[model samples]
Target: MELLLAVIPPLLCYVIFSLCKIGFQKRDQRCYMLSYQCHKAPEDQKLDTGSCADIVTRNKNLGIEEYRFLLRTMVSSGIGEETYCPKNVIDGREESATHMDAVSEMDGIIFQTLDKLFAKTGVSPSEIDIIVSSVSLFSPAPSLTARLINRYRMREDVKAFNLSGMGCSASVVAIDLVKQLFRTCKNSLAIVVSTESMGPNWYSGKDKSMMLSNILFRTGGCSMLLTNNRALKNKALLELTCSVRTHIGSIDEAYRSCIQVEDDLGHKGFRLTRDLPKAGAKALAMNLRVLLPKVLPPLEMLRYVITYYRNKIMKRSSPKGAGPGLDLKSGIDHFCVHPGGRAIIDEVGKSLALSDYDLEPARMALYRFGNTSSGGLWYVLGYMEAKKRLKKGDKILMISLGAGFKCNNCVWKVLKDLDDTNVWQDCIDHYPPSTIGNPFSAKFDWINDESMDFARREDYLPLLKKHSR
Candidate 1:
């Protein structure tokens, strides 16, 4: 009897120890998103089609060809008249490209976003154990994270990371970094800030490829607070489940698809080559190869495998287009697609077989805010929240494409029904507008006329005035 009693106590202790270890492991993997804030620039910073045309007129390097290209791109970009630009661009000082302009622009966005985030979450800056900031085109001397630490008076031992050149996928990459850190740091809080600096990187060159950036990118940013604290679980809006990233930078074509280079005239610009769409498609396919299995339901996975083989066996006799892809709707409830541009959003939507409802947030975000680079995804998510599309237990998939020919995607489980209007406060009601057409094409389509003189600025003044009214 005594022998059996002794064994029982030790066995019980071992089972208890195993349970505790498993509990701790699960806790370590927990990452909760408490709150997020998207920056809204003042009314004075709004960039309309007229302001854009005026800026183009000021650029002596551009001819009629460039003007027509810009107009065509702006008309089809899926951006609206209310998008904001840096103060320098608003003031017609784009060519100056001063360091102060870049700093001030970032300061305006980061400070406002952080301020609002703190207010909404009621979380003190001192509680932040880690800080991650991403700005693809700008990395100043002191670094953006250092600037935040100085401005917020954060703790001396706070961990800080400033990521540059990661492109639009940077925010997802930042979240992945925080998730990894959460595994080692218990009960920790982290803040992530994502934005792009347009002032210094504004392309003055007439390279048609480079000028595309000017028409598409705009001023915006976002700040998010995340925590692994079990106490804050109820307060979290979403719980990040997984993140997957794919990069094709080693391929020659993909590597050169999007890059920052100096034009023949020694003017710096970001070039988007014709190969970009192909590169993005390839990267997305590779990323989904790993990601879909993790998130898709078992039956959905089986359906995909069967369909894939069925198509492969009939390859020679099959039609031109590949048959329908996996049904993401089976598992995901909401999609926060990055609003890179009109064509990008359209292509991704078609490939995923998403409904108009799934594509609305991306389209509306692009129309309302233009492309804010890494920060763009958050704006799309904000749109979903404002429309009250998110519900408790629903899953949201976020997909972001970046310059390294990289595609980064992640999934979030909504903690509750979120209805924050965020940066879309004044404009959410009018979203999914009747149409996203811009006035640029109507006013400047005349530039495309072969008979029109390409060189004289004075000759266009009367037309410009006529269109202005």
Candidate 2:
């Protein structure tokens, strides 16, 4: 036993050290993260690595797009609400369906998003040294992260980390995590994917506080790549400028804002609170403080001090949240604020004093993809990418909230231009423009045919009863 123990520890250490060597060697040349762009079976359909290499070698012309987006690819579970209609709600003699059933139905937003990512980035799993992803709300039995790791048959040595977000701002939080690991490390690849389970996570109870959640939050997600290798720096995907993390204490009053937990009172499932707007505001203030060290320029810091005293001595002019002269806009040219809710968006917009154009990507994302939670930022980036607004040197600011009662932000440096040639560029043709208000609805269909959980859905009564919205 002693001999075995000694041998194992040394062996493990050697393996880890060896992995570090490989990690750095592949740093920047790693393949892209797959988004839901192409369902066509790759040359290696059931065999993951074969397809991965195919993807890696296939996207040679991707970055050639006319515009450039700094951070990463946008993704989501295809929204379930795109098919719902408000007029149908009023005329509804039909059931008030729940989203659980439709969870795995066709055109799943998540699948397509992953496809888009793979097609655009031209990355495959075999090429990745690490897999880092997160989803808030929906969790499959075997776990999606594990499924991906296994599906890709990633290098047996590949490192994997999957997270379930408990707060509203967690998507960018995942980005922060990915950025930290990639900065000190190299060659190793990190795929930061964020998503929400709006379908299954939805509330059906009459609790007014909880009822509000049903009114807000839509489906969406985002996926981005990170590598410290020098080879990939010329196109500069996103730079890990810095990050700020802040959390607020949770209490009943505060709780009413963002949770839908199954509490003591036979709480069937899901709930919402009305105070989310204020809670989000409070959280954002803390995150802003955290985000400062990264975005604050020395000149701006000096100006902030000057503004603080000037406002105090003037005895009348007081800035609303953070003190005066702290111009985040001056520090970055783009914004990807999470579109959690209209109120939340209004709050962030007002607090940052960002103009409509500055928030156009965010609003447009919300209009198109809904509140994909953590992954929502990618959608906004795609908007910028599609619009060809991002330039080689432009900076983008991404911020989000999460169920953990936290707020987070990430900064990106545009690398190459957004080439219209990427496979996903044509997808825009399928979606309606930003003007179509109420462009989303939530529904869950029975997936007995498409899923392995057929037994679970066979007992249809309870499942349908659960959908009694």
Candidate 3:
């Protein structure tokens, strides 16, 4: 009887251990977005409309209508005066920089951003288990992965990946890749860097479709640190809850919507066709069709299903299906829609039935920083953080459209109340202004040179003189 009692206790302990082992192995792997940093270019690179017109006219490749389209697009495109240009491609340069110049610019951006991020998180370079980077336009020998490794002197066994040609959605793609790796790597760290090499890819060609690239693509990058280390949850900013990706490259028209080609004049440029928004909407719908079922509240999903069935299956009157319209706010608290362009933002917001408040971050990011390609979503998030709009348990939907007709969506839950010190600290207070619209069309009499002089005398002179050495 004594032997039997001892066996019983040991067997119970074994059973408990086995159950815990199974539970731990089966538990979902959690990925945390610890922190991110954006590289703010120097002020000299700001390209206003007048400078853009001068550059286009000097290129001598575009005709009158093309120039007019660029100017009109610039005015209504949501890009403000703060979008930057590479030093080699700034106004009056006559020629954009060579491939090596692009490499140099990217090197500086990537290094600086990573340095800032590490300093912020206090995560050692040696602690990073994986390195993933995405740059859409340029790829050289030794690869960007090699450059990062050599620059940071990361561990020799650290796995590295350099993703190219994926375009703007590449950042989330890199995030998804890192999340998948975290499943096996245990409590390890991954660094995802997204930036563009714009100098070499500048189009001097006459193709109207191709020239759109020159006007919209700008210089920027972001570095993000993600980890599966549960101990770091207190310091982490967000928990990645869901990731969804859809690729429609098989469709011929969608595939050609954004493509890189050598123009008739043999100048290389990316062609962004007019049909891009329509194709992107379709792709976004397909992604959400799968994603909404998983993340949306039950009633919201039922409403969408009922509306969809009544319109298509029940042959009832379908009012909003004729255009983009859906009440996604019922499920999502905040959205980080890709600020690819003004038209794209408008179309996606309309399709999703998002209010102006829901879109303020994206619009403000575009207005303040132009499209930063793969890093654009991070800028939108930065704007939200800067404004202190996020709250714990709020759901943030991050969606981006890229080349290869791709749509990527990631859902995140705010882990805690985020601090105000972020990338947008310098300009947050100046934004989401008293009014919101196309900055070019908006009339502000008080902002003229005369009014500005009065403000300088009344407000700025004392501060300037006090601080001036």
lDDT of 1 at 294: 95
RMSD vs true structure, all candidates: 2.5, 15.9, 8.5
Ranking according to TM-score, highest score first: 1, 3, 2
TM-score of every candidate: 0.94, 0.67, 0.87
In candidate 1, which residue pairs get closer than 3 Å at backbone N, Cα or C atoms, i.e. clash?
none
Q: Tell me how far candidate 1 lies from the true structure as C-alpha RMSD in angstroms.
A: 2.5
lDDT tens per residue, model 1, 273-370 = 99999999899889998998999999999987887788788783534333247788788888889999999998888777777889999999999899
Residues 309-381, candidate 2: write the lDDT tens digits: 8878988566575432478766888888876656566678888787778876676566554565665667677
lDDT of 3 by residue, 1-469 (tens): 9999989998999999999988886453889999999888877877755455446556766544454466556667778766887777774553656777878889878998999999988999988999999998888889998988898889999999999999999999999999998888888899999999888788887788898888788889999999888888898989998999999999988999999999888998899987798789999999998887777888877786778777777677656734333456666789999999888898888787787898899998888888889999999999888888889988899999999999999999998986564768787878877654443343221233343443523353333223221
Flag regions of model 1 displaced more than 4 Å: 1-20, 314-324, 453-455
Worst 10 residues of 3 by lDDT: 460-469
Model 3 stretches with alpha carbons more than 4 Å out? 1-22, 26-28, 91-96, 306-314, 321-327, 434-469
Candidate 1 similarity to native, TM-score: 0.94
Off by over 4 Å in 2: 1-112, 250-256, 263-269, 319-324, 419-469
